[model samples]
Target chain A: MQPLEKTGNILPLLHEIRHALEDLLATGQTMVIDLQAMPFAPSELVELKEILGVGEVSAELHALGKSTIQETAFSGAWWIVHFNIDEKMISQTIEICHIPAILMAQHADIQMGLQQLSSTLGGVSL
Target chain B: MNQLSLEERLRLHGVSRRGFLKFCAATASLMALSPAMIPRIAAALENAKRPSVIWLSFQECTGCTESITRSHSPSLESLIFDAISLDYHHTLQVASGDAAEHAREQAMKDNWGKYILVVDGSIPLGNKGFSTIAGISNVDMLIETAKGAAAIVAVGSCAAFGGLPKANPNPTGAVSIDMIIKDKPIINVPGCPPIPVVMTGVLAHFLTFGTLPELDHLKRPKAFYGQNIHDRCYRRPFYERGQFAETFDDEGAKKGWCLFKLGCKGPTTYNACATTKWNGGVSFPIESGHGCLGCSEPNFWDAGSFYAPLSTPIGHVAQNAGYALAAGALAGAAIGFANKQKSSQAIEKHEEITVNDLIKGETK
Candidate 1:
């Protein structure tokens, strides 16, 4: 396995990962992404699992140099990804793999419309 | 001689013809008897023979006396003095000092073991010095007078359960008449100031039957205190619909919703106030928008704050709480299943049991 350098531009990486998973789903292959090495929120993990139709993702904390990749089959194809990074590298990786800007921009527009409707109708503002 | 009609008997007894008729009308109304019972009441009253009486005033405020005096129909003058030979009443008798005490002794001597004793207060036992009427301790006076009486009528909350005087500290050590006079039959007509008609009604019942009316465990006449006020309350429909007045002058209050939430004690109080009412059947406290203070119940003053709600639980675990919801759910399910089963059975039994046959079977 080759080590992928963790980068500060995390959103681009996350968008690419989501697109890759969506393509893999269209090809009728199930995918499971192990987030054991990543410092991420459980709620975001749950949302990611729901979006990808993955079976399960296990999380654990351990010392450096002991990290390993466990391969599993999905619709007759085997795939795995593993990495070991310092705290700074982890933060840079998160920044690079955060949610996409286009989806955020769309969400902002929807929220703005909701706020206007609430103000006009005297209901809860978004 | 059986020679006098009711009108003639009244005349012979010094009750004028008009007074006798008026008494009959008042008796009929008080007893909730039909107007037609006037003649029967008249006959009963005419033959009553002025049952011997011994009136005792113990540790009381004399409010019961004040209340009976305000009766407009027959009036106190006619009811006490003429209707029955009031042998001894400290307030009403003209005699005073030793003369009054001698009269009481003479009346007891004349009608030994044959007079009705009317007690209007509690007995104080904290010390002999707590209460004394005419230089005699009330405890001694009550016990001495009660021994020779035929029956006893405790005529207010004071005499029934020591009333307000017995609340909390109860420094006087006040106790009801029932606590002292344990031998003879006792009837309690309890209220802050008992309704006048109820007092007279019990007297009339005793006169007519020659025995006490039916009584509850509290020794109150069951005819009057038999049912809880809630059972007969006019605002019960609003309670059934879950409507309640949250405050005294809210829209719900004006609309006459149940006063349960506003500290109404009617639900737990047993009395005839809701039905018999007060002030000549004009209106009771609840009718006037004030919650029931439950003045008739024993230890009413100490039964917690008068304006506090019943403190009953109001959810599924409450005695009858969630009953409507449970019943409706079960009934709806049962009806739907029964209908489905009936339709399926109808198809199977179509030829044998026609609709006419089913109707005939139902009738049979």
Candidate 2:
């Protein structure tokens, strides 16, 4: 595919990300840009990722298929890509935050863990 | 699977909360919902009861069934089916003849007033003999089944809008489900065969909320059909710049220019084909360099030529579209063909060779 960069939409997106990163630093506000919602060419997506580059932290959650969460070269800006069981890209997002929400443990799961840990203890004190 | 709760089914599938959360996030994006709703969606689906679905096929090609069932493995539709009880589907159900008819009756008797009624294909009204299931007429069967249904889901253009059967010469006097079933809330999921994910999305919404999703004037889910294909089209830039592909394999075509002149119906048509896409996100029709057939809309088969510009509606497809335009209205902006003179002028400005050669190498 061609760059499809003729529209110059990439420049505005970069500016948006920069502004979002700034907002994160100043006010601790988190922003998520849903990549699928926008009309992005495949080549344009590649261009955006290359310009963002890779950062220090990267984690892959092997849950429903495989999803990767990686911080870009710019701190507080992370890229998260989700795939289905067949390993097709389903959702991709650029989140401006210290940590994306999917990484956090869910409350219900925590409660279930607590129950399991209690049963595992079985009269033994921690 | 039918007896198990969605929570139990997920437990059996070895899906964790994080995994389920990932699914919900993807679904939220698919439904055009914000990230904030992901948690709620997860909670609702995790504990959802298995709603029995009774599918009735009338005047259809069974393409809708094929589209939904033959979906890629571990898809949302597959998961939804695992969670719900598909009590009857004439095409998919193993039982046939009297056994199949009995199953439908038994399911209706069991879940009456609560089960979902999914109707595919148009309903013939010309004569009772035109279409029948076990000697029962289409209208009679629809009216009988709809009476007990909590809600009716009109799947495919046939069931939703009388499809091809009700075209210019509508032989069987075919009519859509909504035209007959008035007492029930009908959700129309239209397409020659709607994108599989969309049909599942509507089902998921109903399962999660215990109610139908917000619908458009056409009764299609607003989230999926709200945006115009042209607005979200990748070649929209070409249209804005007044560059167009006058022919299929011309210089402009190779350059990925706008297809408006080649008769794209993106401007007026509404559907999720552009964003949600089809065939597991491979590509949509426009991306493959064909005009939108507007198959999801009422009387789409009768719409102007798939090759004629949307503005000029005098071709084979246009005659059908003209009537709908009078009643349905809006043929979009009257783009002047005067821009044909500018095509050659823009060619001189292009200098870069595309990466098609590399793609050709990869194919080899």
Candidate 3:
């Protein structure tokens, strides 16, 4: 809760992530940067996000968990942070890709939703 | 001859104003300039004339040219290079023989004291026949070509530092361009074929500002060579934590540990490979899991085994310092006598010797 205290240097990590984004931009492949392993305070996370800066676009997902995904100023880069039911910080990662995979609706969920919509329409006789 | 400015060329090539501004921003960051300089860079580049560049290659493998020209696809970097009036380049020039020589002579004459002279490879001074362009010896050709140039860009380790050709013993008596041309303001871009973008970046800086960029002690553009690879390396965190890959196939290596123990010369070497990367910023040598060979440093070939640690002494030494001291003391009188005899022999061998004779040790 106190801005996650940073025990390790973050500049080198950011440098690596920048290069990973470069690869993603060129290859159209996605790169995931796992920040869960590092000891990062919530404060430090906030500071890092500020340093990364935000893009115009952002999205939120509420399926398996409450996830906030946002793009950075650098093209093809995204930061995703997950929160548990208690709203405590659980995991954080930076993804470099055209579009974040977490935002994609699962095929099974889409099919199930379609079937439910059809059943509702049938009952309503519309 | 009049040519379209860089901005005009970009417009002709369908690069939008927004795209040009983006490039300016990227270049500004690349040169370590603040974002505020973006507008200034854009303005400079917009009206910048494509200067005449004369490229000269001596005793090199053509890797430098290949790195700058062929590394990336036909991108903005290549487009800028193409936009320049490259008057002379043996490998790339279509003219051959007398026609090539005539073209070089004409370019020098036309852009007298105005053209940029970019040189790759070391100059061999062992003999006139060691290396030559057309009928002129390497040193002769270099001196002649350099006379009328405004500024010289020594582009690659060979031209900047003598490189492999100037290694210990130096069979061809190889020397860098600086050794020959002292009058010209020389900017060295030292790397065994420097990063493609670094080479282009230096050119862009020159085109933007009609003077050379700020230089380091080694005369390399400070923007690119200012930081050591070790300082910017991603594995530096591992190194700080006292983690290192002891061997190529070790667990640490597999886990992407620091390559310091595996003879990464990144600590001593200065270049932008770690940050800018290679092959479209995809991955540099360190990212590919190999230690830096420190190709950007001078005399890297004679620096010692690439596999050896930085802490290891480069030269062989006596097993015991005490024994070496004792041996030196024991042989002192004999060495003095031998020196006297050698001096007498030198006097007897040459009737009248000049400075050149002393330099070449040509008494006999």
Please report, in order, the local distance difference test score of every candidate based on alpha carbons: 0.66, 0.86, 0.79
Instruction: Give residue B171's lDDT in candidate 1 (0 to 100).
Output: 88
Candidate 1 vs 2: which has more lDDT: 2
Using DockQ, rank the candidates from best to worst. 2, 3, 1
* Candidate 3 docking class: incorrect
Superposed Cα deviation of residue B221, candidate 2 (Å): 1.0
Off by over 4 Å in 1: A1-126, B1-9, B12-26, B32-43, B72-81, B312-364
lDDT tens digits, residues B38-97, model 2?
Answer: 878887877788998999999899999989986757766677777678999988899999
Q: Write the per-residue lDDT of candidate 1 for residues A1-126, one digit (tens) a residue.
A: 212112222344357565655665577433322232122221343444344342232222222211222222122221222212221111011111122111123343356568788788896454
In the predicted model 3, the residue pairs found to clash are A3-A42, A3-A43, A4-A41, A4-A42, A4-A43, A5-A41
Report model 1's chain A TM-score.
Answer: 0.24
lDDT of 3 by residue, B1-364 (tens): 2477777776676554544554565455545565457679988988888899999999999999999876444454655576578999999999999999999999999989999999999999998799998989989999998999999999999999998899999999999999999999999999988988788888878887778999999999988898888887767778888988899988888877888888999999999887677765556888788999999999889888898888888766556777888889879978988999999998899678566667664555
Candidate 1: tens digits of C-alpha lDDT, residues B1-364: 2334434555555543434544454455555455456677766765666676778888889899888777543342234334567878888789889998888888899889878899998888889778898889999998898888889999999999998778888989999999988999999999888877788778777765568988999999987888788777766667787988899989788776778888888887888777677665456787777888788899878766666678844334554657877898899999999999999998988787556675544664
lDDT of 1: 0.66
Every model's TM-score: 0.59, 0.85, 0.69
lDDT of 2 at B114: 91
